[model samples]
Target: MMNFHFIWPLSGGLLIGLSAGLYLLLNGRIAGISGLTASALGWTSGGVSILGLGFIGGVLAGAAAVFALLGHAGLTITSSPILLVVGGLLVGFGTRLGSGCTSGHGVCGLARLSPRSMVATMTFMIVAAITVYVTRHLVGGF
Candidate 1:
């Protein structure tokens, strides 16, 4: 029998992929969350993309809906506040340096067969594995 634990995540992944695919197909834009955020924040020369704002709003709404429905019963934050802040900062820096986030590179870029996205995604995965190993074994506190 199949494990029920995977069903929710599988459904979420399908929804994400469908959204990204539709966004790309309709808008002719890559659904890179970082880029969208930057554009929405008016950091880009384009001066506040409406599409970016809409995408961000949709993501937030979806997350809110999920939380409302699920009520955070199984949710837990094991990391300290400082750790989480630092991790968020690092992720922001990494996303900027990488030119895109996982959604853009791993999902959309891979679907489009982009070489840069491919490399970025591989690097992200490798670095994540190394970080996990170090934190869990070498560092001993994470």
Candidate 2:
């Protein structure tokens, strides 16, 4: 069976909504992954640390389950571990500089109608567009 479904965009949206709503109603915290992870890493808030780790674990587990069902055919690109690591590092750095990742700023922050989040989301969108353009045309690699 071909499972050509956008599960995360749908199910992940639901989970994010639930998390955000619960965070506000019960804890009064926004479900921003970068903020949560920063607090967790800095040990500033133990509660956020636990939630951040759980959120990350859930995301990874969900991705792994999807890949298992999808058979992991296009997981690799360019066949370079070093490039992949470098790319990951750059992404993390950008996320830090931007103060929130796509999920946080794009989904949670925007939903909460935060001006900071609005700008941050726009930055991500613009940066992503430039990245795709460079990757597809300028650099020309898969």
Which candidate leads the pack in lDDT? 1
Cα lDDT over the full model 1: 0.92
lDDT tens digits by residue: candidate 1, 1-142: 8669888799899989999999899989898889999998999999999988998999899898878888885777898999999999999999999989999999999999999999999999999999999998999967
lDDT of 2: 0.76
TM of each candidate vs. truth: 0.92, 0.74
- Predicted candidate 2: what Cα RMSD to the true structure? 3.3
lDDT of 1 at 100: 91
- Per-residue lDDT of 3-75 in model 2, one digit per residue for the tens? 8567756887787788777776787776777677776566454445666677667767878887897787554
Off by over 4 Å in 2: 1-8, 40-48, 64-76
Worst 10 residues of 2 by lDDT: 39-48
Count clashing residue pairs per candidate.
Answer: 0, 0
